[model samples]
Target: MIIYTPPKPAESIPLIDLGPSFSEDLAARKAVAWEIHKTARDTGFFYIANHGVPQTLMDGQLDLAREFFDLPLEEKIKVDASRSSCTRGYETPGLQTLDDGSPPDLKEGFLIGVDLDDDHPYVKDGVPNCGANQWPEQPENFRTRYEAYVDEMFRVGRHLMGLIALSLELPEDYFAQGLKEPLFNSRLLKYGPQPVDAAFNQIGAGAHTDWGMITLLLQDDVGGLEVENAAGEWISAPPIPGTFIINLGEMVRLLTNGLYHANMHRVLNNHSGRNRYSVPTFFDPNYFYEVRCAPTCMPENGKPDYPATTVGGHIAEMYRKTYGLAA
Candidate 1:
């Protein structure tokens, strides 16, 4: 059973300055990688500053979310997620339950990914979560702005992956092959304050680990995100202006052979009174990329705890479990 717990101030989640990671100096980049290595080993969660995404773009994305969510229900539902084969549209509150045995999440969201046409090979072959996005018509320039934001995210995500390779003592381009044609799903989520008589364990988003390799999250100032520490205590990850929260995911754990872990986190907007907004981009390798234990992560004498899996396969299973869809 899931228990709702109030979180304490965070003491272990580190705030990492990513400026050095973008430096031309190899030593400077390696220094940043070392810091990431330590944090990933201990907490699997951190905040990144100097990430290079323009302030205007970030603010505009948030403004777009507010504008879209403010649309009338009738208009928003016109592109309902259920209507899309790839789940690239709006989802109503309670549509997903992130934590097993807990009440459904108190959040509504819009999901989108790399836009593809009906004739695209991936779409024609019915790749899970791969196809054109169902865009809303009311929000002017919504698609144009969001597409630009996604491009910037892709840039950051790829750069971080390079750092991660270095952190594992491998060449910077170790994951380059897999990333050649990457896949990502960006979600714009809004959480209203939980009701006074809400069900037990009900919250904005349930306690759960992310499904992909890494998650880059932009959260509004009215913070409610909480991450579970190694000791199982919940600590608040309050919003730090100009920084984005970065968290490892299950796939990363698999790659590192448990040398790193995916920490559990949840959201509770109770104290904020007003609605909370966040945008999380789930960055991953190409759908068919084989995820296996990295050479540096191999145990001295034992095999990897997890078996190798394909990126798309693992994500498909996770989606099925969370959305209660048939296998």
Candidate 2:
């Protein structure tokens, strides 16, 4: 059975200042990378400040989420995720069960990815989660604003990936090939206040590890997110203004041959009468990019613990498991 200890205040989760990373000096960039390397090895989760994304853009995205979720259910469901082949629209609460054997998550969500046309090669070939998005007619400037935020997120994601490579003592552009035309799934999630009579193990989001290489999460002030430390204690990851909570995913664990961790996290919006909102962008490599252990991460015997897998294949498997979708 799954058990959740009440979260204590965050003490070990580091807040990294990324300003140095954006500097032209190689030594400054490497200094930031070194901090990331230590954090990745220990927690696999950290908060990044001065990430270069504008505060206005960040606030606008959160405001948009509130506006979108405030719409009448019928209107919100107009562009239901069920209507899209690639699951690129609104999903009602209880639609996804992130933790196996637990009740479905208590959060509503909207998902979108690179806006591709039907004629695009990836769409034509039926690449999983790759296709046009199901946009809502209501929220007048939803598309334009959301897309703008997505563009900035892509930029930050790429830059962070470059730093990740440097963390592994590789060239900054080591993952350039995989990053070209990368695949990403950006999700806007809303969680209502925790119900008084909630079921066992029920929460806003379930205890689970992300499926991609990295996730950049922007959360509002109604703190509820929690991370499980190496000691199995639950630690609160409260919102820090102008910062995004960054976490490594299963793929990173594979890439580092288990030297780095892919920590388990979950959310519980227990605020008295308020809702919680968060946007997490699952930034990953190209769909077909092969994933394997980095040379520096290989074991003494020259054998990796995990087998090679493609980005698309791994994500597809995760979707099937969590969403119970057919292959």
Candidate 3:
């Protein structure tokens, strides 16, 4: 019984480790995928185990994340989002701007990527990954390490798509063609020790569904993520030390005809005076993918009223809004 509860902190829900999910045998793999699919379709969220993300790598990333944020304010401000495309740059506290009518987010972040090109329609400025990257000169290996992580994440993210397709009873390569030359955006983020608000809602990020296809998240020891369930109920999402939290994003939900929902989630900034850092490598459809209904996803007579849209076009609009450029 998936009840539609109001939005708030979750009481309790069984957390399952994602280990033993990937099997060499077809039947075994399908079974694991289905279990995850059922949970995702039912709650739009879940804890993951056997996700194959290394603890050392995640810990190292966290340490470097702290180092990156601890740099002098002047150094941090050099690559501000205002100076790049795709909003890649450093954003300090009170810099968060979202559609939700909440106070400033209690966090800061550094954004980067390399998807920009003169021919790539998404690029508006020199920044790649939607804009230009803010490379740190002091940390000689920062870019290399982050890029390595992103590559590994992308590798894992692609596998997840095949599993998702299998769970939906679709072809294993269902999402492959469109993913060639895809526009990928990975976020290196940090949260915590933020200003308090009178309303008592200490928002690190707003309550919103990810606008992409899927998100692979790497979180540190401190946890404060919450996702809205089927009944619109909030469920606590904590750190499991060595797993990547994967969630179906809105585009995937739409592509699957809502079989998997893009859950609404947010970060709560109440960490006993400790900071939280999260890194997510978003796996998105290549811009050219025509995000339309498949026979398996939608019946001939059950097509959605909305017109079909390209994967890139829809994201471009969302990107504009996320960066306050949308009209």
lDDT of 2: 0.92
Worst 10 residues of 1 by lDDT: 4-13
**Top model by lDDT, which number?**
2
| TM-score, prediction 3 | 0.87
- The sequence of per-residue lDDT tens digits that candidate 3 reaches over residues 1-327 is 999976643344335554555666788767767876777676666566676767677788777788888789888877777776556778777576443667666668886655355565555532223544777764459888887787777777777777778888888788888766655677667877554543455478878888778887888878888878777778788787677788877787777777777878888776478888888777877766787665577867886644677766787777666655741
How does each model score on TM-score?
0.95, 0.95, 0.87
Once model 2 is optimally superposed onto the true structure by TM-score, how far is the C-alpha of residue 222 displaced, in angstroms? 0.6
Please identify which of the two predictions, 1 or 2, would achieve the higher lDDT against the true structure.
2
Candidate 2 versus the native: TM-score? 0.95
lDDT string for model 1 (232-263, tens) is: 88889989999899999999999999888799
RMSD of 2: 4.9
Model 2 C-alpha lDDT per residue in residues 50-114, reported as the tens digit of each score: 99999999999999999999999999999999998888899999999999999999999999987
Of 2 and 3, the candidate ahead on lDDT is: 2
Q: Provide the global lDDT of candidate 3 against the true structure.
A: 0.71
lDDT of model 1 at position 204: 91
Error of 3 at 47 (Å): 2.5
Candidates ranked by TM-score, best first? Answer: 2, 1, 3
